[model samples]
Target: MTGLRVLITNITLAGRTGTEIVVRDLALGLARAGDRPMVYAPRSGPIADALRRAGIPVVNDIAAVPATPDVIHGHHVIQTAVALARYPQVPAVFVCHDREAWHDTPPRLPGVRAWATVSDSFRTRVAADTGLAPEAVQLVLNGVDTDRFQPGPALPPRPRRALAFAKNQGHLDGIRTACARRDISLDVVGAAVGRIVDAPEALLPAYDLVFASALTAIESLACLRAVVVCDGRGLAGMADLPTYEALRHGNFGVGTFTGPVTAGAVGAAIDRYDPVMAVAVGQRLRAEAGLTAWTDRWRAVYAGILASPAGPEDSEARNLALAVHLQTWDPAVAPSSWTAERASLIRTLARLGSGLEPLDPGVSVAATDGDRLALTGFHTPEAWGVWSAQPTCSLRFRPATAFGPGRIRLRLAPFLPAGSPDARLTVTLNGQPLGELSFPGADGAEPRDVWFAVDALDGVTDAWLGFHSTPCRSPVSLGLSADGRRLGFSLIEVAIEPD
Candidate 1:
């Protein structure tokens, strides 16, 4: 397979997300294995920069590729379609990473010689979706760069420090509570927590145990850290010698997460941690899940496809598949030429189709109000409130009665970790600045009644309330608590009252 030109396509190279990381490792590994590998992504960012620094060419435009590739290693469906359409003669092996994601749907194209999935779950999904034989979908489990994630210092008798490494921050409160009960210091790093570690290989060594799923769990095991197969979906318990093969077959992903995430569940997972057993698991992973071996598997797939290529589909069939792929197009990832008007129209149509209704006036609504009140930039609601996960959060609703001068009251609590500054919020109504509200650092978690006068509501039937707060900081960074979520403030309740 040496000297084969491989064109790898992905949706974005913006961040170290799951698929992006896979593409990054695959390209680097293929290049090191003597293949001429180039990457094509719709958008470029840090991951793209890293690939370029490693001497692998990355292009956003399909036309920019210097020459046609011998084989196409396609990822997301949209970008894969672009590559396949551009290089009609090239045979492609499409890899499906997610079972539920629209973009991960296997392409029904004739030029696609093969299909690969990262787990047994995804393999089953791809096979079912494409109506192919189960054996036809290859299972290509994700691999870690074992050299980069070498075993760290010996673990203590018990885990003194732990990490919750997942992009989906589901049921984190339970994990935090579990870690607190055991007196184990916990930190979090993931997109949901506003912390994206570019080199998790460097970060995994510091923790004796890691609460993660999929690739992160594998990487942590390679670092000799006891791993609990858990993520936003749920808890999957500890990955020890006995369960490693089963978990590995499922890619240590959602399929393994059979139990709900709770303090008891997480605590039980922690109880299963064994330092000696953890090192044994790491040794096994290093032997079997190395990037080099993984790359070789892919090379074999490409070679096999090249040896017996599938015939190209008829023009009508190809056009129908392309049309189906276009249905999954997201304006957020689309080119700058995607007009705002078009995006707005799509959203409007979606909302209308969804049958969304406005919140009732004079009724105080809480964070758990769900779809009754439109909320954005807020995390999943807890029993008491919801944390604003971003720098700004907003609420949209239609006034039940005719508009008049009024005041909006918000019961909120600032997320002031120890030694951090107080949170200041700039309020906005219908896109116009209303006023500001400041909460002292001492008022942590204690809901305070903050009211702001809004005269602009006089003529508005629909109202948009925005809260722009200071930058949110994670408690792990401040050494205040084990919670890794970057929080600005918590919204407990909101109401609008006539002046």
Candidate 2:
């Protein structure tokens, strides 16, 4: 096994997302076990740089690979399709990490001798999508590098600091409100908040509790943090001894998020946190979900596939399936040129186009009607209005009448602390600067109309209006309260009036 060559394929090595991290850990772990592991990703970034430094070869071009591998461990369908096509005789095992993501769709190809999934939910999904028998789809639960994510110092009797470690920040508002009520400081670190950390293991030890799902939850548990299995979808409550096995079976993911995500619900879940129980659960996870044991499972899968490789008679079927997959999902480009970010941008643009509506000149557009308009970077709507969650927010509109010089008025309340300076809000229309507004600290929570005069409306068919405000501050940082969200302003309404 010391000279066993393994080629791992993934969509992108640009970020520390779930799949990307998994590929990194698996490659490193296999190499540590004396196997030669190399990675092939179309898009490369910091992760690829790190792998190269570790003596593992990461290639963007298939022809650059020095030698063929004994087994191909494929992740995303696009890269897997490319690898399988290039190495038609190679035995490969495809692993599905997500149930709904398009890239996680299992490919039907001749070189693919085995199908696997990271969770029970995705096991069923991959089986259904690939038309494989449920028994045929192997369940390979996600694992954490226990050596890297070892437990830190002992936790306090009560949690003083908590973390929401998820890429999807859907549960943040509720988690923030709940943590505030408990007098606990909350911090967020994920792509959703633009706070991605390459080494989360270094950060997880400082928090007494962590709110995450799937692989993140397992990593947190291994770090001896009280884990709450929740994400953008909903809440699954705290992971305790009573519910540990059930949640573990579900991969501590969406399958366990059966409860609604609200301040009250999240607060109730927070109340169940037990530092002692956290230690126990973490010990169990470290034993059961350690990377060494997980790598052994993968090695076994590779050996099994190598022993009984699928026949090459399904080439026509495989080609037809690949063609249908490409046409139905992305027909304009080849798999080698595709990236996850590009796909997301296209989907977002399509949604924005479909959501646009005719904007009346004199009528005010209320924040409550956000669903009817194209919007981004705003939180869930409240009775009064919607709060801009990020430093920048944007909206799209299409005026009903001919465009001309006009003033765009917005009724927004700045989140200024008692002694802080005035908050500056800069406006832009169709990428052109419109105007800037300065709101004094005394503006308070009362909404005031701020107008931005525009010279012209060039893109009258679909005008994109943007707001870039000064950096946001949290109530906890201001020592006013316990809320942890970086507050900007509450946008109540927007109206356009021709000059």
Candidate 3:
């Protein structure tokens, strides 16, 4: 299938994470199979650079994508939305690489001819969550480049070196302690290690053992290293034949590991390492998870989608627009509520202007649904912060009762290092300035309140809080810190007093 244009979209291709690595390798595979694959992302990083060097086309903006492609493959919700909106005619495929809850109910977009997940478990879960038939969702297991990760002359075992490579730092200390106690020299890699290596997989032959999960675990096994599946959650023990089978169905136990990741537990897993088993694991992975076989599966998938009927150009457009709007629009303040007709969505967007605004004074429109406010931005359970270079987040609230003239105050703290002068922020409410905010020039401090007074709130019931802050000086260059996160501030709470 020469000149089959395959457009792969992702949030970004700047890091060496599992998803990024997969996207890069898939593009390479497509190119090798006589297909033209162009990667579309909003941001670029080392991975993007590497793909370009491999002769794959990479565009940072969807608008810049040349002509219409045969198929659009998106890796995230935002990417799917962009594909649906920008290329309604193209058949689309959504790839579920992570186990995020948000992905379960993906953007109800049009032209999504099929869906693919990295594991069988997700294939079932995603099919149920997205309302697709079980057969509609395909299991596209992650693959490794055997040419680069193949077994080599095993390094000497005198020093007992184990490479700890992971983006998640949750169980890092426990793994480190375990390696220290066992007299194993642990060479940690990945972004969480405060540095990012270009091709860490190629270095796997230098180690006797590797602590990783998902693609990394598979790669290590392919590289003839004793593998342990551990990440932020905990440990999934050593990967023997039984565990390997179990891990395969769970994407190498990416989010399925349920055990505690203690030093002793990790040490025990390390103790089970046998050089003979490592060699066998490598051979098995080479035969099963090699790039050629993986690429053939993708090729078949692409061919199937292309051969199918032309998808409805307007299919799921309304639902997708609604999902995208609710993430940022404050219905209490917008022209229309959630139940408003689709005709009203266009009018509401014009009234809201994609900016947070406080509701106007009118008949007391007490919200019966909920009184809590919803915040929009990237946040993990462990910490909350803006994870964008130029971070701007909007807070939507629905008061239980009609709001009278009152004051709105916000409590927020910077998630920056001590003495970061660049943490200054400008606050706004519906485009109205609420003055600048400055946090304590230190980390680990309680958030302070900043108040905004309104002239009239006679019947105001819904409000929005907007924040803007400085962008990261070097988003792509933040290596070893392994976090390409562009953070602004961590919001604590919001208080509205009816006067």
Please name the candidate that would achieve the greatest TM-score relative to the true structure: 2
TM-score for each prediction? 0.66, 0.67, 0.63
Deviation from native of the Cα of residue 417 in model 3, angstroms: 55
- lDDT values for all models: 0.77, 0.77, 0.67
Residue 314 local lDDT, model 2: 69
Residues 443-499, candidate 3, lDDT per residue (tens digit)? 555667777775553443334455666433433211111232334565655566667
| lDDT score for residue 135 of model 2 | 65
lDDT of 1 by residue, 318-369 (tens): 7776676565455555532234446544665675533234444533445335
Candidate 2: segments with Cα more than 4 A from true spot: 312-499
**TM-score, model 3 to reference:** 0.63
Worst 10 residues of 1 by lDDT: 474-483
- Give the clashing pairs for model 1: none
User: Model 1 Cα displacement at 476 (Å)?
Assistant: 47
RMSD of candidate 1 to true structure, Å: 16.9
For candidate 2, give the lDDT of residue 399: 70
